[model samples]
Target chain A: MNITVNWGLLAPILAIQLILMVTALTSLYKADATRGPKWMWVLIIVFGQILGPIIYFVVGRNDRS
Target chain B: MRQFGLFYRKEMLEMARSYKWIWVPMVFLLLGVMQPVTTYYMPEILKHAGNMPAGTIITMPTPTAGEVLAQTLNQFGTIGVLVLVLSMMGIVSGERQSGVTSLIFTKPVSFIAYMTAKWASMLTLTAAAFACGYAGACYYTIQLIGSLDVGTVIQAGLMYMLWFVFVISVLLLISAWLPNSAGVAFTTMAFIMLLSFGTSLLSRYLSWSPSRLSTIASEILTKVETLSSVGPVLWISLCSILICVMLAVYRMQSQESISAKA
Candidate 1:
């Protein structure tokens, strides 16, 4: 089972994930308030792949502030 | 019009500050590219799982580029719609609930202008996010699957975008009418799901339903349906969007008195 991985094919997915992560982190840092603890969101954004960052961006921020 | 411009600028600024501009398009781009990449890697993915019986031959036919693009649209139709709705659910109701609407209304703001500004910003955000998603999907599909006609993709994309606009308009109207963001999101999602399900169940009777926009868009890409067949439904959807905008304005005006009470 020596199938070589195609980095070319996987690059876009990685790039998108990186963008989502960075955006989530940036927003979390700037957010005056969040739905829950800031530390929890930081963990989610760092570990949650595509969905983690999205959830934080969508519902985590307390937009009222 | 000047007021609309100022309000739109404010909306855009808010979007930027909230990171909606960055994350929404990124999510769409991710959703777009995932379909083709996953489809391309399914065989490898299955093999690596190592749970299959020995000599389990997987002979899945590769899907055509058109099929892949259509599949991407299906992803957009479901999860993409959910993201858009959730992100925007609080646009009107949140403001109203938090007393921002009352503050704004105390000024010489035109309700119609305010609503139109909101509609414009929603359209801009949805359109840009969708374009990014579709473009990402197209790039991956063409690279991995096969080539597609650019004209066909544009036509299909336009049709699908109309459906998206309809969905956003519904959200805006619900947000304007409802008192809570959760209610706005839930009602909009329910209406969308019910409309699509009902159209499918009653296809013959509801051929002109806005829900058919998604199907027609995919059909255009698949080359199974002509554009002429889509005309009536497209017109119906455009009218529906117009009605939604008008209703949102009317609802917002009425909400003013309620906000006054609060």
Candidate 2:
């Protein structure tokens, strides 16, 4: 149980998740309209972990709007 | 050919504008990287689960690199497919709903060119994402698990890529035939799940099915698959993809005539 996990080995994974979230959040901010409320998507993108941003990108953003 | 290139470029631009270019591949990379890392840490992960008796030794066989890579493919088969399908579900239906298809139809656009362009763009994105993900998985597997044969990995990757091709083709056909994006997504997901399940349950009767591509890919990784054994499935997959594309093109052409008469 005392095994020390190397942060270096795990950094890239966390970094990728951060990149996804940042991109999703930026897109949400710029969009004038989304499928649902803007705040709801902001919440989802930030709290939805890896899948949060993906869901927002796939279904949340209303391109027609 | 010129018209196809134009439509293909437009589709790619739309994908880039929508940020599909960035996020889809990122998700794939995350999925690919997590698999090998988690497998390498399985013992530590299980040990930290708690409630084990004092001095209880967790004896686990280390999985070979090929096994780890195959497990990565399984991860792609489920979650990777979902992300890819959902991202693509609206390709045709969305354009139709937004009146864009009608607007374009008013011009001298051929439905064949348009449909083929859409299919080609989707296949491009899928191939890029899969390649990035698989390469990441290979690097991590070699570093964390062990070394894998390069030939085996490439062969397995090709087989698995063909499965994605088949799935995307089916999705394209459904999106063309359906009017609603949600419906397109639902039907495609259901059909895929059924095909995968039925293939496994009726493996004897459906050995040549495209659904067998995943199993064949895994077998290749494990060195249990031969070229002759994979030939039928590969041929069937390519043929089905061609059929789906032709059917979708026909659907679009018929719809064009109907709209023109109206």
Per-residue lDDT of A63 in model 2: 89
Tell me chain A's TM-score in each of the predictions. Answer: 0.91, 0.90
| Candidate 1 iRMSD in angstroms | 1.7
lDDT of 1 by residue, B1-262 (tens): 8999999999899888888898899889989999998888877888877788998888888888998899999999999999999888888987877788899999979999899999899899999999999999999999888899999999999999999999999999888888899899999999999999998899888999999999988998887854336779988999999999999999888778675767
TM-score of 1: 0.96
Please write out the lDDT profile of model 2 over residues A11-45, one tens digit for every residue.
99999999999999989988988898998998998
Candidate 2 segments exceeding 4 Å error: A1-3, B53-57, B225-228
Best by DockQ: 1
Please report how far candidate 1 places residue B111 from its true position, in Å. Answer: 0.6
Error of 1 at B33 (Å): 0.8
Error of 2 at B41 (Å): 1.0
Give the per-residue lDDT of model 2 (tens digit) for B142-238. Answer: 9888889999899899999999999999999999899999999899999999999998998888888898999889888877644336778889999
